[model samples]
Target: MNGYRFDKLKLLVADDNQHMRKLISTIMKAFGTTSVYEAESGEAAWQSLKKIGIDIVIVDWQMAGMTGLDFVRKIRNAPDSPNPFLPVIMLTGYTHIDHVRLARDAGANEFLAKPVTVKALMAKITSVIENPRPFVRTKTYFGPCRRRRNDMSYKGPERRAAPDAIDVDGIRPVGSGKTGSHGP
Candidate 1:
């Protein structure tokens, strides 16, 4: 049963650049993806959505016919919502803060600054799958970490920890005080 859980996932790659679309599609296939649908522009991407189902979307920031942001807006606005809870990763060469903010506002779950490496893309996919919420940067003894949910506010980290519950960095606890207990 556990083996079946990690089956191939269908993905969509949307970019006006033909080479970019091919590159993303190829990378996804290399990552054990089952199928990858591609579109040269947002308009074409929208049409593709109407035809087939996709598990996730990897879109370029700038495109002709319609921008990637607009494509996301359309997906989120569809009557039947092609993928209502679908995860989207926006790729852009530009690193402007405003662009990142715009992508967030436009319903992007992850952002990859351009010249994105295969390792970076894989890491982003892994992180988003493990925690499907906005990424919040936080520092810890381990290293720079990402907090998944907004409500994960640790009140000075004084609470007893769970035995099997690993930290955000997937590190197992070496020692613990107790479990099923409370503190003041």
Candidate 2:
């Protein structure tokens, strides 16, 4: 709240649950957000996104018309999207590691599990405003950089290269192709 000017920001809240929408909106207003939009489903949210000047999006994971994960994918990869770089905060009841990874892979800038608290919501908002992640474009993905920060303490060989090191042809360096045999 120190540097963030919530009064000037425009936010869109997308959720199928009416009560959830109202609750989030109320919290947003309490946090000094003056302009907030609501959508009942992902389709409706997409429509609003096309028409409004939204600074941030808080979308639930499950919806009627389209899932939140799909919505985020569309926003990040769709050629007709109004703002591909728009910051998105994903809200989901599923707090499992798989769900979090899915949200991240879908290009969500932040992830917030359900049973939302004012403190967590405000923290996420502040993070998006104060420390925005850089957008990255690759053959398989086109959204915010997946890596949060560089680990300077690790003296071993670089596990991942910097985003700037990516080639102009949208090629990302290949990592170890091993995948864990367990879990979702």
Candidate 3:
């Protein structure tokens, strides 16, 4: 808590429940975040994002107008999004691994379970602040890099080789559209 300074951060708390919104906002205030805005629905939150210079967004998974997953997807993939790189933390009671993966795939930077606490909230905020993931733009994905680690020492069958190099599995990617046999 003392290590991180949220005084300069402008956060948005988007939840359908007014009480949950208030609780999260109070926690943000305790963290010294002065500009914490609240939105009762995902649509309102999206509107706020376009208007506010928000540094981070804390959204609930279950919202009326738009689900948290939908909001995150829009933020990451929307053609005219205000800031695609904005950090997003999904706060919800859905602690299942599937739910977490869904949030990650949807472009939320981090996921926090419900029954939120000051310590947990602070930790999540600091994690987002201290460690920002690089954005990836693949054909189907356009958000933070999903992989958390890049273990260079691990020798595995799936290890990625250079584009022009042959893999350990003897699968050579066709280079410059030159068709060739896989024989050595």
Candidate 4:
């Protein structure tokens, strides 16, 4: 029987380990990635990317040719390209926060430790795919608004103006015997 979705997604899984590459591709296929691509090295991954419209990239931190850090830097530095908005996830065996921070600073949208579980991996992929953040800001405004995970601020629909209450105008006795208009 078929499982979760496996369509309309072009994912690239880059790793030096053939086994790991297949594992990630299979997992992504199971999770409804229709067009999953695999690369055995950073250079191969970069070459594949040049030829395909990859929606997400799962890269290993350590690679033989251009390291994952270098690959990410390349993507981030290519700000003028049409596909510069690609969401990248760095996969590594390292657990240090500094390592994770460095990956983020180097243009990684998310970081995952090696031997990643299907649940965690799927969650990470889904998060990045569904909520890719903006790399540059065109404009910013501050008001009563909430920011989405993608960093887009949304101001809710405009509120309707309150209806004016009915007014009664009539001559009324004020103070002694003087008459005056009561309402307007």
By lDDT, is 1 or 2 better? 2
TM-score of 4: 0.69
Error of 1 at 172 (Å): 28
- Count backbone overlaps in model 1: 0
Q: Report the lDDT tens digits of candidate 2 across residue range 1-184.
A: 2756779989999999999999999999987889999999999999999999999999999887799999999998888999999999999898755566577778888888879999889878878887777666656677775656533354453234443332211223344232211111
lDDT values of the candidates?
A: 0.64, 0.78, 0.77, 0.65
Candidate 3 lDDT, 8-109, residue by residue in tens: 889999999999999999888987889999999999999999999999999999987799999999999899899999999998898655566577778888
> TM-score: which is higher, 1 or 2?
2
Give residue 32's error in model 4 in angstroms. Answer: 2.4
Reference-based TM-score of each model: 0.69, 0.81, 0.80, 0.69
Order of candidate numbers by lDDT, starting with the best: 2, 3, 4, 1
Model 4 over residues 74-132: C-alpha lDDT tens digits? Answer: 77665443366678888998765446545655667777887788987977876675555
| Order of the predicted models by TM-score, top scorer first | 2, 3, 4, 1
Q: Once model 3 is optimally superposed onto the true structure by TM-score, how far is the C-alpha of residue 150 displaced, in angstroms?
A: 5.2
- Clashing residue pairs, backbone N/CA/C < 3 A, model 4: 5-32, 6-32
lDDT, residue 162, model 4: 25
lDDT of 4: 0.65
Q: Which candidate comes out best when scored by lDDT?
A: 2
Best-matching candidate per TM-score: 2
Worst 10 residues of 2 by lDDT: 175-184
